[model samples]
Target: MPEPIRTFRHFRDVPDSAWRWGNFSPAEIACRGTGQLKLHPEALDKLQALRDRLGKPLIVRSAYRSPEHNRAVGGAKASKHMDGTAFDIAMANHDPAAFEATARAVGFLGFGYYPRSGFMHIDLGPARTWGERFPVRAVPFALEVPAARETLAESRTMKGAGAAGVATVGAAGVEVAQGVLAEAQGAVLPLIPYLDSLRWIFIALALAGIAVAIWARVDDWRRGMQ
Candidate 1:
């Protein structure tokens, strides 16, 4: 049996579970100009797989198109959008080369590069590629670091400051201990000089930590600017 076209007057009419594919809603693949929608299951399945492999959101520029909508947008007479097989995905959240590779791996065969528009078209049709490829980027898209990791790196400036606080507390603790030992006994007098020395060591460490904390804070600020 031929695969049936899933039609919706509006995406809102689609029951949530009716969309078997996860990570995508009927609205996302609906016709842009009209509320109407029609799509093939294979296309949505492949698209969901692509999204899963990428582990990120896809910025879909265009997907399904009604015949009227297709003509208004000056789409090809036989554009894949009408058949619900083509997708125009923006590269804002994706690296073009990587996106194409992943799209192909998920069974998309057609490629239409629109460098100036910053979007690419992919379809489950005859294997072919068209349009000018994007200029090789000096830097690929930055990997998304987990929020926890980013927060830890962003808080790096605090480490030195925290060390300084600890050292200051240590120095104060040494002085208090030195004073108590001074009043203990004559036999403990020999330990007095060492206690004083310990106090001085703590003070030196405290100063060093403070200096490091200052430098780290400055560096963190610079990074934020960049």
Candidate 2:
């Protein structure tokens, strides 16, 4: 049988002094950049516990998000942030794995490691994990343009030189053309290795996206199971 969904009152009852993390405040966690913050009691409790265990300041990148704000940021349809049960914390000073471990020990069920963006997401939602610790650098397609242009110019020069003097151009022009072709090839050949690397990077990114989607589905299933 499917378990009943847990409901939370959308309000903040805890006093300011209750939040041990002096650096973080309810105002910063509020939706739409407003000072009015509403958070699930358990979420706040676990977060504070995690902060205390770490013995360091935790920078909250994002917390409670309004439905409109969530949509604008392309958040998941049933994002925990909407219910103030999620937090995206900066990973600058904190070690990702250590922070994640502390968060889990403090009862956060959802974990997302985004080393590229320098932030980790923790939430009191269905137990799930996603995202990459090492980010893939995108291949700049612009680099290829210059190499292609040089190749084209070399080909055009070869053609014009050959037509201008078939006699003198026959031997000397053929030699020069071959040299230009070699130069162009030299310019283009190096990019092949780089292009191959980019192909793998693109494939990896696609696979990562698919993995995240599958993870979300599994998390939803787990929620149902609960």
Candidate with best TM-score: 1
Instruction: List, residue by residue over 150-178, the lDDT tens digit for candidate 2.
Output: 35445434444434334332344444554
**Residue-by-residue lDDT tens digits, candidate 1, 106-154:** 9999999999999999999889999999877789988767544436545
lDDT at position 189, candidate 2: 54
Q: Which pairs, if any, clash in model 2?
A: none
Candidate 1 TM-score versus the reference: 0.71
Count: clashes, candidate 2: 0
**Residue 211 CA error for candidate 1 (Å)?**
6.0
lDDT of 2: 0.67
Steric clashes per prediction: 0, 0
